[model samples]
Target chain A: MTLSLDLSHRFQGFTLEAAFTAPPGVTALFGRSGSGKTTLVNAVAGLLRPDRLRLSVAGEVLADTTAGIWQPAHRRRIGYVFQDARLFPHLTVRQNLLYGRWFAPKSPEAAQDFDRIVALLGIGGLLQRRPGALSGGERQRVALGRAILSQPRILLMDEPLAALDEARKAEILPYLEQLRDELGLPILYVSHSMAEVARLATTVVLLEAGRVTAAGPVAVMLAQPEHAQSLGLREAGAVLQGQIAAQEEDGLTRISTEAGPLWLPRVAGEPGRPLRLRILAQDVMLALQAPQGLSALNHFESVVEAVHLGDGPGAMVRLRAGDAAVLARITARSAKAMGLRPGLRLHAVLKAVSVAQENIGRGA
Target chain B: MTLSLRVSAVATVVSLPLGIAVALALARGRFPGRQLLNGLVHLPLILPPVVTGYLLLLTFGRKGWVGQWLDQWFGLVFAFRWTGAALAAAIMAFPLMVRAIRLAIEAVDPKLEQAAATLGAGRFMVFLTVTLPLILPGILAGTILAFAKAMGEFGATITFVSNIPGQTQTLPSAIYAYMQVPGGDAQAARLVLVAIVIAMAALLLSEWISRAVARRIAGT
Candidate 1:
């Protein structure tokens, strides 16, 4: 099931007009702050009516301004997990979770079992406690459970983890992954955190100002230099599709990709289980000739596809190694010295430890 | 003292729903004349009590327009009667109640209501299940304030209903009546102590209730 949005809304000093489809699985609306991601999500949830909208969940049309058809938010069956959790402080956690269930008619398939969700979110201990007593992460988890119990056709999470610290965000991620794989429910996740989007989103819609600058499969979207530049040099990276091949005794795991077998720090995936690794652009270095390894364990023979020069001394080099697309960030001086241009045969080198544990996630 | 208690309690109860409705409108409504409505509700707070009383008498006297209409239809009258004392007290206390409740409503996060709406709750349901309960402590404080004000109201009550013994006489009016005659200091002094006791008890009860409600909502 997919949620499609083609809407336009005018705001003072800013206008948000976007059209994008949230494909099955986690489709992330990735953008920096003040990019209007939340407002777009609100339009999908029917909380904010856009000036013009044609939104549908699965095949049911929730709103189409031109068609003169609109549904009120309460009847739309969209489960929204806000950034702040927004849990009713007066109600116990159990009551908060069950609050929405009372209003939604449950089909056998849509009816998420109460105890199972409590277990899924690990919130059974908080059932009797009010929202005020829960920590930030716990509150968000309860909010997610509450939204699910409402039996929504699709889930809309607007930067639900944005308020949490890194540790708290890490704590909630595994549960979110489990929700994606187990529930088979499509979700529209909005976030400025590229790491979260890279880890969870199967599809990426990059929003800038109030418009979608790019949209595609996560792997393709991550390779786009336009959004990569906007994401800043630190988060600019490419995702490599690979499967774990072996676990070396020296605490390194072998992952086989189309490019070649690469060794990295031990990951949790079992042998033969596929995984996605995000190699930062800066972590990769380009060599004009076959480079002898000093300490870098991974280097691939590749051809330069594009060179994007930044305003400063830095440049992003897009390379094609076998079937994989690798990105290398280097100084413009080196590119000019090496005459790095499209179709130039070269080597893309990477430090194995440079791919931090946070940069790796299980395959979708 | 019993008459005073009855008048204040009756006044508070009668005006509770209206007070909440008006407060909600003042806090959230954006309709035309909203400012005018706010100013009118607060007129009794700033205007001299006697002036407010005079206006009420003109509007609700036995032969007054609304009073005559009510008398003919509902057979209800508020002239020189205990009911008149209650009406005058309610008017005098309206602004305090509305102000407290409005502040509470403003303190509530509208984001919670939006969350409820996404959960399939309509506007009214959101209010009943979330907004109303979340603001429960505020509402109680507002009610207690209004009741206290009603208990102490003398000028408006006297001018509107007059201090008729056993009928329109409340605590403050009775105290004033005692002071008007010589050698009635003992009665007036005793009533003054009674008023202090009643006010103290009310303050203590409100404190306890506020603490209990706050603890429940805050989960401390």
Candidate 2:
């Protein structure tokens, strides 16, 4: 189902104007802190009333201020997974998951089943436990299950992983990917992390100071220089569009990208599925002469588009491959050694195993 | 003594829900003249007992506007009846009950109520299930306060409802009656001891109940 949100809300000393149509997939509202990403998601969930707003989910009019139509939060059918999880502390995990089901409109046959949600989120073993007894990751998983059992047409996740540590984030990301793939429900995910946006988002909506700076599919937007500035040089990288070329022996998998065929550690998925590999700027090594790499397995010939020297001890070199651009953050010593300059011809060397499977964005 | 206890219990029970409703309104709801409503609820607590009783009598006596209407419409009487005594006692205790409940409601986390609303509960459902249960300790405290106040109510009951024997004469009224008559001083002193015991017992009972509820809800 499609979710269309066009809203303008003004708060004290801030005005939020955002408009986007998210298709059935995970659409990440990417931005920095205080960019009104949470405000936009709250508006979609009917938690915040916008002055002049028009929002509809799958053709159902949820809010249209000009038309004098506004459905309250309860009737909106948009489940929100807050950053804090917000699970009912008074109830057990099982009761919290089933809390929304009791109020769900009865049907002759429920399409979005309940038991399926329990197994999907892997909360069967934790049904009897309270939210306080569960770990951070477990609480998030249960929160997601509760939201799904509510049978929401669209799910709004606001930094669901922000409160979690890196390890906990890794633990919960797979379940989120499973939900995106299995449930077929549209999700409007809010986050400040571009890595998360690159990994999970089919569409990226970049917000800055309460406005839509850029919004489009992950691949094209990430390639733009404007989008690159949103992500800093060190974190900025190319999202290599590729398919599972082949699985090599010794547990490494080869994938083809616009730059060239690349190999990475074996990912836990079938062959022929599309994958997204994030090549960080720090990971790329530029060579004036195509040096025979001692250990690195992937190399791509590119033209250096621009070079920005840092006041510290490094330089950021932007490289353009076949259709996408890659960044290389190299020390000034190495840049001078290689005689690197803007519009210079160079070959970028990247280690095959250095690009871990965790960086790969699975198919939406 | 038993009549006084029964009168206090009846008055407490009758005014408990009204006090709770008014408390929640004062704590949560926004309306025009809210401050005025708050002051009106607190008026009896600040005013002298005789003054409150005089106001009640002026409005609820047999020839009064409300009393005449009740006599004509439903043949109900609040003038010099046991019901009238209970009303006088409830009015005297209403402020204490309302103050306790209002503080409790304010202490409850509103985010919990918002969470309930997100789970498909309407406003009334959220209040009934989430807000009310969490404030039960406060309600119990309010009940005990109102009960104690009603048991000690003397000026209001005698002034508005009259100290009629076997009808409106509660324990306090009986004690007052005995103190007025010759050779009834011993009876009046005995009733005072009964009042102290009842008040202390009510206080201890409320404390026990409040602790039990707090432990259960707070999981301690």
Name model 1 segments beyond 4 Å from true. A107-112, A288-293, A352-364
DockQ for model 1 equals 0.83
Residue A286 of candidate 1: its Cα lDDT?
A: 81
Residue A109 accuracy (lDDT) in model 2: 48
Deviation in angstroms for B154 in model 1?
A: 1.4
Give the range of the ten consecutive residues with the poorest summed lDDT in model 2 chain A: A351-360
Q: Please give the clash total of every predicted structure, in order.
A: 0, 0
lDDT of 1 at A301: 93
Q: What is the Cα-based lDDT of residue A82 in candidate 2?
A: 85
Q: Looking at model 2, how many pairs of residues clash?
A: 0
Docking class of 1: high
lDDT of 1 by residue, A1-364 (tens): 8888898998877899899888788899988899999889898888888889999988889999999988999999999999999999888999999999879996574434888888998999999999899999999999999999998889999999989999999899878877877677889999989888877888999899999988998877777665677766788888777778999999998888877779888877679776667888888888877777467888889999999988889988888888988878889999999999899999888853233222124223
What DockQ does each candidate score versus the true complex, computed on alpha carbons? Answer: 0.83, 0.42
